[model samples]
Target chain A: MTALLTVDRLSIATQARQLVRNLSFSIAPGERLGLIGESGSGKSLTSLALIGLLPETMAATGSIRLDGTEVIGAGERQLVALRGPAAATIFQEPLTALDPLMRVGRQVGEVVRRRLRHEGLPSSAPAVQTRVLELLSRVALPDPERLARVYPHEMSGGQRQRVAIAMALAWRPKLLVADEPTTALDVTTQAEILALIGQLVREDNMALLFISHDIPVVAGTVDRVAVLRQGELVEAGPVSDVLQAPADPYTRSLVAAARTFDTALGRLF
Target chain B: MNGTAGSMPQTEGKMTRRTIPLSLIVGGVIVGLHLLAGLLTLFWTPYDPTAMVGGRLAGPSLAHWAGTDRLGRDLFTQILIGARIAIEVGSGAVAIGAAIGVTLGILAAFATRTLDDVFAAAFDILIAFPTLLVAMLIVAASQTASLFTAVLAIGIAGSAIIARLTRILAKRVLSMDYIVAARVAGSSWPSIVVVHVLPNIWPTLIVNLALQFGLAAMAESSLSYLGLGAPPPNASWGRLLQEAQGTVYTAPFGAIAPGIALVTLVIGVNLLADGLRAFADPTRRGRR
Candidate 1:
């Protein structure tokens, strides 16, 4: 079967510099792939391109097919239609992922209602509310019923990220792109969030495109990995082969950095 | 705050924690009395405030309180009606300004970067033009000096200020991550405006709205003072002030009565606005 997402010669550029250059990849149904790079490596740019949320100054070229639909050069209406229902993103910062004034229930209900409408299912208030609570429960949020009524500012960072995850899964999207989803989280919360994401991927049969800078985070979360350096995909393969037996010197250096940071943190404590 | 947040303290909601300020109480009483005077006019005033009741420019007495105007109408009645007109004009113009201005602001925010630049430049030009000048020009062109006309002129002029404020506020909101997340969550543009945009900017908007109330009252009064607002028979405080000016040496009460009313109301409302800004600070601690 054709892959769910196929990118061919994808290049993103601004006036000053090329952000991503001729990168190509594909993600099949239910597959877990990680895009790993350091800061300024265009990992986030690639993800934003997939969602059609690039900055106004940046221009993207090449084919980005989500299922059968082409993303690049698509009109806004079509991109809007595809973005939430077909794919959803869990942004990096939990604190800012939610509308502070809004009740958490309404935020999740928004996506639930949209997904329900898209699926030709009951999209009434009660139905959406039920589904929002269910999704919150799925993410293992504490007191899902009560959590829904409160504003995001009332929640902790971990709870907020969980709420974000619940919102992303409201559509049961075919592809889930979590860009450094746990980067802003505490270590324990990060583990819980990662595990929760892994569980959801399996349960929903989602094609995961998890993006992060930390080598170990990618190794733990995804099955296959694509390593990027300075807007170029330097290496990509199965998680075990590329990580345990890295071919590229750049990949080796990232591995070295990850290990040194871990050791340094351990020694400091 | 974090320690006790999630355990669900049902009564101590975060927003309700801030202690009400004394200015709010004081200002509320003054504004409340003015509104009460306006409402009481609907049923009764000591006498017809507009009707000729006693000697012109007469001083305060039990029969005709606050004395009489140039037309020999009851000064107290004129002041009460003036308060009503002031309230009406202030709220009416503010309503119109808010509706039109907020829409324009959000539109400016959602416009392309270049178009947004154009809007920003246009706003600067419009804001540079004096509000009273614009109101005067609009009233002159319309050529009908009535309360409604004054309100329309003032509203249109005030809209530019509101629009500028809204555009700045909405742009700041648009740049927030939560707004983007709402979009990614499949919220339509209208939903984003209502749910994400308006609420986030609401406290600041409220503060501006209160401040605009004072400004609008001043604009309406200025328009009336220029003979371009609430033409005779309507005792707008501004017209009352203007009429009392020529006879100031003879009887100071006519000028002094409405003058005190206007200053007190404007000052009260402005203080109320200030108190609201302080009270709405989300970071302030609760008095538990």
Candidate 2:
């Protein structure tokens, strides 16, 4: 089995200081990897570098090869080719991730039609609409017909997240990068969204790079876990090993934090 | 104002809210009347707008309507033609401004760091140079201050402001996550601009353009008043106002009629822009 994504000694830096330093990770085809980190851990920066969409002020060094193409220093045309069909990202804030002015259906349809165009298939209105509805339904959204007409502001947080998920899945990318996809939702909605992402990844047989600060959530979603602190990778291992007995002291602290949170919740119950 | 602007639409719903805005209604009526008067000039006026058809400084009557100007030309006829000229100049200048401004702005928004700075500096300098001063320079250069010259000067000068506005608006939209999302979804720059950026920014752009229309019209009248506008027989409202300045005490109607016409048009356009801004803003709409 070949690796779907390979990041080798990747370092991202602004003009003033380094943000992500000497980080390396790889995800094999159909594999799920969770990157667990604290704030300013360079987790988000690494994810952006994977898609070649880092902000202009920051410069990225080292190699990021996704499905055989090098993402670092790639031109916009090449990056555009890789973005949807190869890998797509779902950002933290679903409300801002989707376009507010556009109807949700049209938004999804835009991706579907682009995918069709990329595949050299006819992208007529009816054809696009059918596929759009199929994608909406696949994400377990009820009443795809009516939902497509309403704007993003009309939908709840969870529904909007589902729509974002649908958009990411529209092109059937080989890999999905979800950067704190459920962080903006409430407790109940978070569980639902997390489950949906896991189920969709499994159903599509797609690789996933799930970045989150939540330890238990990462453990539940991914097979392998990589822990990041500041700008460096502190630990990498199976979820069971990391959670049950962390090798690094930093990893141990993270597991202990998760345990404390679990115990607090247990006491509440 | 926010509360009133937001609530009125929700309570009225689709039926009335669509046109229920007080500014839009009042502005629409004033502009509509002006438009009717302008259109009337296409076929008829009381007399030839430039002809000496009545006694000079005569008062309003069935024959002369608003009476006559110093030259004995019908004031009512000149005022009607004035409306037509105002509309022509307003639309023409705005069209030119929007075209030049929007294109440059979008280009500047997409420009690299060095190019963007250059564009920004240029826009600032151009904006600081008064539109009237620029118009004077253009007239000086052309040596013929026709309606075309006025429109060109005003549009060119105003383009800097429009471009600056467009650059700011487009850059803000480009920075949004949805724009990144669109790109990730395989949308090309052109596609993203058409599908996302333009649709997001057009509401604000339109509101500003509406305001620009008023400014351009006023600028045209000022040019005519300064003797740089369309020559005699065109009967621009500014020329009428200028011509009536001396006889203002004698006729009173001469100055009052064109002054009222100019003010009404400007007020109408300004109110329309205000109404549009209130209606189109999402944050304000979200309050409802």
Candidate of highest TM-score: 2
Docking class of 2: acceptable
Question: What is model 2's DockQ versus the real complex?
Answer: 0.45
What's the C-alpha lDDT at position B237 in model 1? 92
Candidate 1 off by > 4 Å:
A265-269, B1-26, B271-288
Model 2 bad stretches (over 4 Å): B1-20, B277-288
lDDT per residue as tens, model 2, A76-110: 99999999999999989988889888889999999
Kindly give the stretch of ten consecutive residues in candidate 1 chain B with the minimal lDDT sum: B1-10
lDDT of 1 by residue, A1-269 (tens): 88999999999999999989999999999999999999999999999899788878999999999978999998877887887767889999998888777788988988888788888998889898889989989999867888888777667888889899998998888999999999998787788889899989998999999999988878988999999999999999999999889999999988887889999999999
RMSD of each: 2.8, 4.0
Worst 10 residues of 1 chain A by lDDT: A149-158
